[model samples]
Target: MDVLVLIGRVLFVVLFATSAVNHLTRSKAMAGYTASRGIPFATAAVLASGVVLGAGAVSVAVGLWADLGALLLAAFCFSAAVLMHGFWAEKDPQAKMAEQSHFFKDLALGGAALVIFAFFAYAGHDLGLMVTGPALSLG
Candidate 1:
């Protein structure tokens, strides 16, 4: 179980690290791409996303506040997948494939984030606060 958790964390870190590097290095292209997706303040958005991605990756890799890192990374990925990669624009085969791939990847990442969150919550880790009661309230 430890090995599996470590592997999952490493994978998430690697994925986000690569994305962060891309966003940081290719700011103009990323900004343009984001703008094309109807996101306002594309440049600022890319920069902010890059910061979150990089920070999340580092935190997860170091096993420091990993749950929160996973949550933030999941949010970034979900937003990018849904807002940037709209399914309606499937005219280009390549674009369609990329968009679909990102969408599924983000979905998987979100699941991973949930798993991490559950682990931290159950282990009594200081991961923010549960405002609505127990983390896993069945009722």
Candidate 2:
């Protein structure tokens, strides 16, 4: 059971962890896209975003201060979805559909993070400020 929980934690963070490296390696291209979305200081934002993602990934994966990690991820994901994936603002049908998908995906992931935060932070348990173990478990 503990092993499974740890596996789940690893799986949850793998996407962000892998993408954090990509974000840094492809900063120029990513920043260009981010700027096109009207994000100010696009290059710096890209790098900062990468850092946030990496931090969140590490904290959550290691189950150390996971609530804070969850908050970081949730805020970033929600903001990105709104700023980058505004499907309603797109006119082209295909483009709108694509953006909608991206928006939903981000929202779902963000919502999951918020839920994780609530579980560890608000639940009469750990308050999510600190994690005593490497994984969350019913035991």
Candidate 3:
């Protein structure tokens, strides 16, 4: 079970880690798209989000300060859903559907991150090499 949990944690963070890499490596292109969505300081925002997400992914994967990592992941997911994948703002049916899918995906990821946060922050469980203590104590 511990091994499985470890695997799950690593797998879960893959998407986010990959996205973080893209945000850093392709910042200019991503910033253009972000700006097209009317995000202010799109370039800086992309770089900042990349750093946040990369740090969160590393924290979770290594089971170090995972509670804090979960919070960071949740924040990024929720903010991106609202700020980037605004389905309601789309006009074309296909585009709306695409945005809606992305919006829901981010929401689901955010929800899962919150659940992980609760487990580490409150339940105080450990799996595999997970740190024995949580970085947060919000019960």
Candidate 4:
């Protein structure tokens, strides 16, 4: 079970980790797309988002401060869904469908991250964890 949980954690972070790499390595292209979405300081935003993603990936993978990591991921996902994948802004039907799909995907990812945050931060469970941090403790 521990091993399975560990695998799950790693799997969950793979997309974020890889996307972070892309954001860092392909900043110019990514920035151009981000700029098209009307994001201010697109390059800086891309780089900063990459950093956030990297940090979140590491934190979640190691189960250290995972709640914080999950929160960061959730924020990134939700923001990207709204700011980057705005399907309603698309003029072409195909583009709108693609954007709508991406928008939903981001929303789902954000929702999953929030679930992770709640599980670790509020449930007070340490099963299958290497190390834990001060939980978010919203209550």
Model 3, 5-24: lDDT tens digits are 67988999999999999999
Per candidate, the number of residue pairs that clash is 0, 1, 0, 0
Candidate 3: clashing pairs of residues: none
TM-score of each: 0.78, 0.86, 0.94, 0.93
Q: By TM-score, is 1 or 4 better?
A: 4
Q: What is the Cα-based lDDT of residue 27 in candidate 1?
A: 84
Tens-place lDDT per residue, model 2, 56-138, is 89887777867778788898899989998999999999999999999999999999988877665654143333355323343
Instruction: Tell me model 3's lDDT, rounded to 2 decimals.
Output: 0.90
Better of 1 and 2 by TM-score: 2
RMSD of each: 5.3, 4.2, 1.4, 1.5
Q: After superposition, how far is residue 123 of candidate 4 from its true place, in Å?
A: 3.7
Error of 1 at 69 (Å): 0.6
Model 1 scores a C-alpha lDDT of 0.74
State which candidate has the highest lDDT.
3
Residue 90, candidate 1: Cα error in Å is 3.2
Query: What are the lDDT scores of the predictions, listed in order?
Result: 0.74, 0.80, 0.90, 0.89
Error of 4 at 22 (Å): 0.4
**Compared with the true structure, what per-residue lDDT tens digits does model 4 show for residues 10-117?**
999999999999999999999999999999999999999999999889888898888899999999999999999999989999999999999999999999999888
Pairwise lDDT winner, candidates 1 and 4:
4
